[model samples]
Target chain A: MAGLSDLRAGFDPATVKEDFTLLRNPHHDHPLVYLDSAASSQRPDSVLAAMDDYYCRSHANVHRGVYRLAEEATSLYEGARQKIGDFIGAPDPGREIIFTKNVTEALNLVAQSWGRANLRPGDAIVLTEIEHHANLVPWLMLASEIGFEIRYLRLGEDGELDLSRLEETVEGAKLVGVTMCSNVLGTLVPVSQIAQAAHAAGAVVVADGAQYVPHLPTDVSSLGADLMAFTGHKMLGPTGIGVLWGKAEILDAMPPFLGGGEMIKDVRLDGFIPNDLPWKFEAGTPPIAEAIGLGAAVDYLSGLGMAAIREHEITLLSYAMKKLEADHGDALVIHGPSRPERRGGVLSMQLDGVHAHDLSQVLDSRGVCVRAGHHCAKPLMRCLGLAATARASFYIYNDESDIDALSDALGEARSFFA
Target chain B: MPGLEDLYREIILDHYRNPRNAKELESPPALRAEGYNPLCGDEVVITLLVDEGRIQDIGIGGQGCSISRSSASLMTVSVKGKTLEEASAAIRSFKAMMSIHESSLAPAASQTETPTAAELAKMGELAALQGVVKFPVRIKCAVLAWNTLSECMAKATDAQP
Candidate 1:
């Protein structure tokens, strides 16, 4: 609710950008204007140092070894769980936060473990047209096996979720899977309202927060979601680390997602007893170093403050939208909700006479890194009637100058193609 | 913008803006196959009419980037009246030109060179696409039409007997 000027007096983009080494890209003569944070954020020096400190000082497998090094490693890993839990306001850090390779795997864990145990044939699973394949495909795979009907919440002409038919969509659904924010459209869905609706229909709600948690302040309790999936890489942390936070009772009741060393209590000839709530879902060795890095990333974000980050991004988005509209006008068509408050800083633009690929190529020549494609949301692209879009997403490190560079490059691309 | 100029050559842009044979073929003798680049959502459908081992007519339909659309347009002209074997050979040569090892294979064939009359007649304007090898990601775009052509040819052969 606080404005950027009101939140943090010392919050500055130039200073904040210094923390990230990749922003100081030395390969190109032109400074790298990275606009692809929605794909994966660039890590900060503190996160890198944290991972380095772990591998250098304390390197051992967790939960199995009793040695001092192993004990230290376990503490660091568990400590990250507490930090991330606090960051997102999870109910119980130890019991609810399960680590996986990425959000895709985390969603798969929910579909395979929780969905399989809870759903039945003829049960319906509600989803949205804007969900990334990560959140859509797993449920589809489960639907094929369980014979559940998949109902879709359509995207409105305004690019936001059309909840006009919310009651009918979630009427007989066993679960409602949705993205908190669309990665392509940048439309922030009303998750709390949707969760309330789903609960009224006697269906649990699972949210894909891969694009939301990084940019905004997240509280699982506030959102009223039973389960949430997010990745570390999109939040200034390393890859190969994702989190699935769920209600402890729900996680405890679900079957294990995979059979492995750490996710078990005891193994016999006939069967194996699963471990506790969260550990039962985390199979094999976890991403120890990446977790440490994520913890450091959390620390960095907490230092800057999430509210400040959100405020900064909103300001940047307003500035960007105004600049783009005033400068390019009819030559560029920006997708999603026109109001900055209604969307995140992700701008999916269609330049006149320039294809997304060609636009991206031209932008790259100018050292502007914008993502161009379906962005793993092909169904959403189909809904928009576009084969692809050239997306430029903003983050904590980005500023007005980067957007200016992108605009200039895009102008060049359009004229070049013409 | 040296690299950019090479990738988006004037000839390539010409083919893209004014795509030749950009229509659907009547079905009786036309064999068609669809090709898609999942990464970019670029889709192309190639329709070929092969009669007695010769490609009598070729048509390309669908939408994509300049690289893909232009490639499809250029492909129709290059293989329209050629024998099926000659079309196949042209595809092979185009693929070879777009290969990552193209520099090692043909070190002297940079974009700066003006093609001899004989060489230009042999390879046609597709040689302009040779610059695509420098950009690895766009190579798939350059090859989508050729791949669809191969698929159409295979389907035509299968339809026989």
Candidate 2:
């Protein structure tokens, strides 16, 4: 079987891991084994340097600056937009990409601006059972105000979406909000297929690509999503910057989400003329340094090649799964698809009688950092009949050694509890 | 050994493995309050049986981590026979022991000036949880049951008259 060694022929995770200064944290006696990339990935030196360079060299608020330094800063920020937009295959980079605080804000922008204008009373918005609160809560909040019925696409016992009743679920739905990948379960939902179904049902497809875009090769055109949201931090970039990619016409049609400086073309005494497609949405003086950092992150990922990155994760995930199952047997139960090919490098594991909190504490002693909680998916937690699970997620920087450390820690935790 | 052992003390593990009053009290006699740690998905339900300004009986029913479940178990045992005022004092003392701030230790503020063996004995087994202050994130888990108990008492008081 192709493992990390076989797949990462030229790519060295150790070398890549070294670029991230946080990975070398001296707080623990043992080496830090960070497996919580699904939450927010650590930024590499290149990303950090890029942001630092921006602040040192081109320190100015974007969009309204006329000075040379301001222009340079604007170029750096917008240039990032173009690079990121191209990286994700946004149809029109200049018009489609809107920057927000994070994926949560991006999703909120869609819910508040697009959803409010389009949705009516008794209109349905189709959402998956496994969506993060970022994707789920916005629509729910909007529904309460707009009086639209929210329908959920339930997950099967196998942890994948039960799409057998897709047509029935999307019936009378105006918008279908779903996650491209499950952060907790690591199950990869076929976004393109879901989008096709949603489109056929006369519903717009809005995808939360917070998890997917980081690991997978994303092409918005092929995915057929009307709008998609993802954060920079999860994709090896800095926090406080997120991307909301939408169709140009759709973005142009929607009202400005927040009325602030850069988002306006003209503010009359009576009413205001909203800015063009993308700017109309990006209200405030955006995360300039963070966006530049995101641009550098994109460059780094492009250098590594997204396909190879995906392959590396698949190889590592498969190895981890096999090793864990062999070592622990019935003691450790992994959630999501049995096959690693069908999932990302996220393993939400349950160690029989050991509480996730207890397991996390024990693991922390060995310098293995894993998230232990409902993973902001309370609905999915209810579906799985679990209060919480210990989630160990991986990224391009992670390899088999980290997984081995994780397994060893889990064994120790089990013994300690026993 | 100091850190991990301090966190998962034997007493805490004992309470977690074998919880006290780990069942729902009959509704007519019990006033119930639910506590949820949304971050960890720890849900604790505390039921109180108050009789003439005293805690006649208490029951804890919930699903949570060892810290939370064990805390609930210990809380039920500690407050069972005490008057509401005394139980509240015990709660205050336990909270003081787990508190990082000097202000939170208001009830036993004078004890800080001179550490007495008597004050230590007053806390009893709840002193096992004093180590929890080190782990700030898990402190909420240790207090989930106590917070719920406070809510249950409030509800019971509100129901009267």
Candidate 3:
């Protein structure tokens, strides 16, 4: 964990442990050890308090208001954009950060906007085989509407995207959309190379960063992504707030997604002109509270440092993989990248003689909470030739003991059915 | 060895190791139904030989968890040769004994009398699985096969008119 310790910028893991309000189980008598961060990250108390403080004192609708409360709220909202810009490596102008409801909407915005404007009939869009439905469905819909061809970048034997074929796939393609880190397989893709290659071919690169942002420091400029989408909930922030970082020129040209308040500069009987840059895309009562919450979440993550978070996660992930392979090798099969740094914290596995659901039941009884399902990554599940898998993911608050609990619970599950 | 006793009570092992009347028959006279638990991926296919509103025979097919498979075996042995109303009454009694409520949980079953162990065993070694309900996930596993029986009967009645 030395690498992780260094990345945390000296945020001592032992001393910096804060109270995560969501970890407290209201229903269970036992202290809940949550291992499902991929599903939703639990919020620390500081983040909750920030939102509470905002609502209590300075909560007001941002932009277009003349009063002091509105001015302060607007500043906070814009400040959040800058914070996100710094957090995600979008420092050119925080105005590049266009807030949406979630990653689903951000991806959809790009699909409906950029896709509609740039793509021509007979052009092709290249997507990796493991794209989450959020990334896949939008492009698929746009392709069908415009008669653009859709192609997939195949997975290698290890389920990682075939880097050998990425260059060829991006050649002459209109756009390339891929996940920075696969939600199910946890394979970290080489976005920089893909982005450079796509640019060489006059193609745009869009990265789905929902799984990547929480585990690593993602810089939009360094990533070379023309567009990227990520959500707050997955990063221990509030839901209903997502960010889409795109080059300013791309956003200026793309069509609007939602209509009404704040998105337009002037309304006319004949036509309404759109607002400038980021506001042009934001429409109809943006998620003010959630934006404030996300700002607070950014502060929390920054204090701990992304490198520290990444390092700790890699340590925990390696520990878990080793434990699963050593202890449950006969009865369980682990899936994902072999190297810890090449993936996020998601671990998918199958237990012998026990269905994922039944195993989860026994685990739940023992006070272990894990997800057992398709994980909304149906395409990836199909690629793996599995209907579902039992998953155990980790975040900052977890340690070696959580892995022990998972291993013990897995043994109990096997015994219960053996 | 933990003994099959840990998972499949002696009665469940008996049913699973030797399923009774485990065969398919002619289709038109037989009422067929499928039961599925979407969350767990357990599925059951049941066919009943109903003769003049009486279950002349009952059998099932499909693969699932241990509790579900064992429950199917017991259900086949228990419901054969019983009148429609009698089988219905037993199912009701069985569901009530399961001690569940429709208001809170989705797709609730509603027969009100809690059947005793003797009554469940009369339904055959199905009583072996009462222990499964204690494990919430297994409750659905144990009930998947029984739910198919109720569907088969219900469809059989609707077809009669």
**Maximum-TM-score candidate:** 2
Q: Better model by DockQ, 1 or 2?
A: 2
Docking class of 1: medium
Name the candidate that leads on lDDT: 1
Q: What is the CAPRI rating of model 2's predicted complex?
A: medium
Off by over 4 Å in 1: A1-10, B100-121
Give the per-residue lDDT of model 3 (tens digit) for A1-418: 2335434435543343447755654425555767888888888787788788888988888996899998888888888888878888786555689999999999999988888888999998899888888999998888888899988887886657887877778888989998998878888888888888889999988999999998898778788889999999988899889999998887777888788888999999999999988988999878887888898899888888887788888888888888988998868888888888778888888898676766776777667888887777777776787766788888877777778889998998887666
Candidate 2 C-alpha lDDT tens digits along B1-161: 34798898889889988999998888777888889998899999878889998999888887999999989998888999998888888777777666633365356655454324687678777777767878889999998888889888888778879
In Å, candidate 1's interface RMSD is 1.8
Q: Arrange candidates by lDDT, highest first: which order? A: 1, 2, 3
Identify the candidate with maximal DockQ: 2
Task: Give the residue spans of candidate 2 off by over 4 A.
Answer: A1-9, B100-117
**Candidate 3 chain A: minimum summed lDDT over ten consecutive residues — where?**
A1-10
Candidate 2: deviation at residue B146, Å? 0.5
Query: In angstroms, how far off is A27's CA in candidate 3?
Result: 6.6
Q: Which rank order by DockQ, best down to worst? A: 2, 1, 3
Question: Candidate 1, after superposition: displacement of residue A244 in Å?
Answer: 0.3
State residue A50's C-alpha deviation in candidate 2, in Å.
Answer: 0.5
Q: What is the C-alpha local distance difference test score of each model?
A: 0.89, 0.89, 0.79
Assess the local accuracy of residue A308 in candidate 2 as a C-alpha lDDT between 0 and 100: 83
Instruction: Supply DockQ values for each candidate.
Output: 0.67, 0.71, 0.19
Chain B TM-score per candidate, please.
0.84, 0.88, 0.80
